[model samples]
Target chain A: MSLASLTKDWAATSYGFLDASAKRELRRKMLKAIAVPGCQMPYASREVPMARGWGTGGLQVTLTLVNPASTVKVIDQGADDGVNAASIRRFISRVSGAAETWDTLSASIVQSRHRVPEEVMREDQILVLQVPNPEPLRGVEPNMSIARQMHADADYGKLWLTLYEQIVRKGRIMQGAAYPSMVNGRHVMTPSPIPRWDVPKLNMAKHLTFLSAGREKRLFAVPPFTRVEPLVFSDRPYQVEEHAHLTCRRSGLSGYFMNEIPQDNGGSTFEVSDSNLGIKAIQKAEGAPTEIGETWYRDGEYSA
Target chain B: MLTVAPPDAIELRCNSTFQALMWALSRPGDARVMPEAGLAGIAETLVDLECTVFADTPDLREAVSASGALVTGDVSRADHVFLSSLENAADQIVQLRCGSPLYPDDGATLIVAARHAGQRLRLSGPGIEEPTEISLDAPPAFWAMRAMLCAYPEGFDCFFVDAGSVIGIPRSTKVEVL
Candidate 1:
């Protein structure tokens, strides 16, 4: 290898494509998130190789925090190899030689979609959620400025009235997925579009839960041991509707919130939301279903 | 240390691969099958990806080597670098790009021809309603460099190809994990 040739090769190497100025600002936002403790901070969102609502926020958080020593785990609903999750896995491995794992237990950082894992997350574990739509009042009021004011003054009478009106009109809350909740009794944040069943599970916890919306460029957090109460009234109390017919055949459990399976026929059919995935744990003690049900379409009916 | 574009900088060339991935993961257990022919039906099957790796490049030179193998070119502009010192470019692959932390979904991918592409840690994340499928080799840690990446979005994303089959994990995704 000639000296001249070596010099020429060095000149061609572009170490990083990301602009230096942009990186600095994002780092500042990240630092603010860590310093305030459970505060939602605005940062410059990047257009990743991936799109918005597709774990882009989580990808940004992971990328910003990535060090040579970290182990990465990406999960959507639980299984790691889902297309979105898998694609993220591919990108991280490319930028760095950091290790990857399917096991959520050992994972230092876990990026999730709708459902948080069934297992209890630790205080040290970091949970990054890719929020499709972050505003709780978006569906109710469709105005961002009003919702911000409502949170600022702790005015949630309207949300209560909306739910109360639903009961008075439809006999129940009738909300399917992406049920809303208040974080720290202040920020009325949307906990992604998860099933109503999982909403109860989000009580005070130890882990650091982050919500990121790449398209909206919004980032928020829920720190450890904070109050997370689902707003409900004394009479109605917030009941999570059930799957009328479908149940986890493997686990022999029924009435879980169910997503639908689009049959060849025009109209779709409904099935268990946590279907085959939830069955894995209790199934062995019970047994694997001689049958499995397929369900869901991307970005549909979470907040409705 | 990488610089980012203006929050709305020069429009970023979208990563077609990521869009295609959102589709795949959004509807788990369903394979968005693609054509095997090299760059043949890429447009039809690859609704969100680009075929930019044409033969007309200044530094790229793909050829068969004496070791009856291949090598990933100097790992620079090649963000999604693929490596397999064992096979010809025409033959099967052993490793590919997967993004790492700071860019987990941006690392190189690997397609080790291991006998099995299903084993190791379990994973789960968004874009999955139920248990999605995975095609990985046994004891992902056995790959040493591969297993260590489990921390996330900070490690390399990978796909294991064996016996004409493939399984993927992007940087933002989580493995089913035990």
Candidate 2:
């Protein structure tokens, strides 16, 4: 009815660092993404203080979800102390006044460039993954429109062919990261760039996962209890990276995904990928009382 | 060096409302409490100048207009539709945008007022670990009509709001009338 009614009071910065409209738009898209699991939903990727490719998509989602009550965690390649992860964590906490934590168990929302935590995510928690490329068909079908059509038709022959070719050439499925996966038995989505070990953590897990790519300007979700089947021939069988046997030289933790550090003399050393888990392992070994939640993997086997 | 902006009342309310709606949709058949009763909180949380809204009631239409969203008379043109009841929503349901397969986000979000208790439904899909049963006031005819209208990856998402609680049934959810 009046000029003042149409506008809001100007703030130094919008809460969560996104304008109200941006949040509304994201809210709408996020709901749709959740509605149709693994289906990519396009949103107006808004600008943040960070670069477009540096977890901006995940950051936006985190910012939209963050509140004073939220406990946030950000990780890059499984380490919370990595520059990108730490900066993003700090940024999220600064903008929203949300609590920040490295421990996956304490985090209500976990945003990561790659890697799901070694610890199992609860039903109430949300995982936000930063995707470099959202389109699984990008390798075969460069045209996004045709790729979308293929998704609509559930025509994933090319995807199968890609796997078949890998079997023919490499004698094993060589997709190390960003494996194409079927969600809810309907749509196939690139489960971000998470390694094969992390893919199973998404399947029918009790946690909600959102994969967003800011540069791509798209987002998708894997709701709790949804099926996330990695593409593989029934004859070949799917294989995760063989890091389960390796132990972390630093934390003495074994049976989890490990980062291979190349030694100067042509050998390789291994360390636990999830830095916080390793930290907790070291602390518990040092006779400190620390609680370690049950993990997705146990004694080198992903029993969950 | 920079000071973060504290969440104002509006931000806090919308953020919480979206959280409720998000969880409601993520776990279909689960009732999540809203910040306030009715569809006003939903409209405030989602509708803005960027949206095109359709509402059956004058109050909601006024509210949408006040939010600076385009108030479309036609249901097909609106991205968000607000209805007082689903019993008489057959006409609107038919015209609601299901969106294209390529752009399912274009699908309209249907918000209807329904009681928390009524006919029971069995829900199984992405969100449900096992088929979960829930009761909603929506009639069998309404669901039948919904099944007719929705073709996966090409259907509108729904939110049933009762007082301060909401239950979301995304298109991915397979609902059986029990």
Candidate 3:
């Protein structure tokens, strides 16, 4: 092949902010990640404008997937307007010319940190989760190589022991976020620090989920219909955060995960963690025509 | 104000090609349409200098080489293996790298040109919600070989391409012949 055929004209910046080779490498890793569900795949973890730990992994995946036609939504801890979420969303739109939205129903790709949207994601939608730690064995094993060996051996005895110890000490499973879950009965993966409430939404769900940790330089995926069972003892069942009874003070919405706000009178006020969902509830209450998609939870109950 | 750069033709093609391939694999047995026909777009979208690929066709080898990837003749050494046809592919399938249990990502990706209709098979696994059946123009022996070779995370993945349509059968997917 001629050198001229391989070369292209210089551009100020590559489309989607990632060079073609980086995208190609991600594409290859992603396919492999999908092939072996929940198994962590190592990647080059190309440098982005943002810092490594702050959603860089999710940003790289989203950038690889984004195009002009893609409608992107980014959230940090269930809020769309948080500084991290807003900046990520704006940066994605600015670089890729993709449509930005706060509504979960309208988004084709949702890049999230520590939360999954309350709305049930469709098969067409993809969820990219920003992960600080991709290794579930990191807590039990300090050495990464040993942890990988444990993963290969499917040796989760230590993880179960940790949970067992927590039960003996706290009388309940005190693991709040990033509860370890087994995917496809093969690999135990941390579902990216999402709450126990959000973890159930991933089990046998319709949407594809990618959990990526930039600092760790690893990525994994959970395809639709895969079994994501939270590790729980048979006698003691899994429990979500006790936010079901609380109501959002502003929107009058209840029966969903809520963010508790401490009050002056030693009381607490609650707001729906999904900010856009609360906003839509407020709009609908005000007689404004709004479309809120069906959610995974209903009436203080976990229902798909 | 930042003016977003419009995707060039190559970028657009790779983006769409990857989209199709991603969704196709995400929901195994579902056919997704690519922006362009044939294996060239797939090669452009995924294979690069980091990969070692084995393409049976001369044109595909040239295309892969142009992409600066090592075009290997050994199927076992290839991370990506492309075959124009699956007929009499039992030997090659045997040689395809299934990767080690420690590093399953080393498993080869086998892309074959096969018709969408032929032998009826049921697929059940990670991507499939309910057990779904599809017809493919491949010998039942191929499925048997795949079943024999694939040991969960250790098995190679496959893509069946027919003109503009592609279907992915990841190793996580269990293929049952009817």
Better of 1 and 3 by lDDT: 3
Q: Is 1 or 2 the stronger prediction by DockQ?
A: 2
Across B35-61, the per-residue lDDT of candidate 2 in tens digits comes to: 899998999999999989999999999
**Superior by DockQ: candidate 2 or candidate 3:** 3
The C-alpha TM-scores of every prediction are 0.51, 0.99, 0.99
lDDT of 1 by residue, B105-150 (tens): 2343332233333554544443233455554444533344444544
The DockQ figures for the candidates are 0.02, 0.88, 0.91
* Order by lDDT, highest first: 3, 2, 1
TM-score of 3: 0.99
| Stronger candidate by lDDT (1 vs 2) | 2
Model 3: colliding residue pairs = none
- Candidate 3, residues B1-178, lDDT tens digits: the string is 8788889999999999999999999999999999999998899999999999999999999988989999999999999999999987787889999999899999999989999998999999888988999999989899899999988879998999999999999999889999
| TM-score, candidate number 1 | 0.51
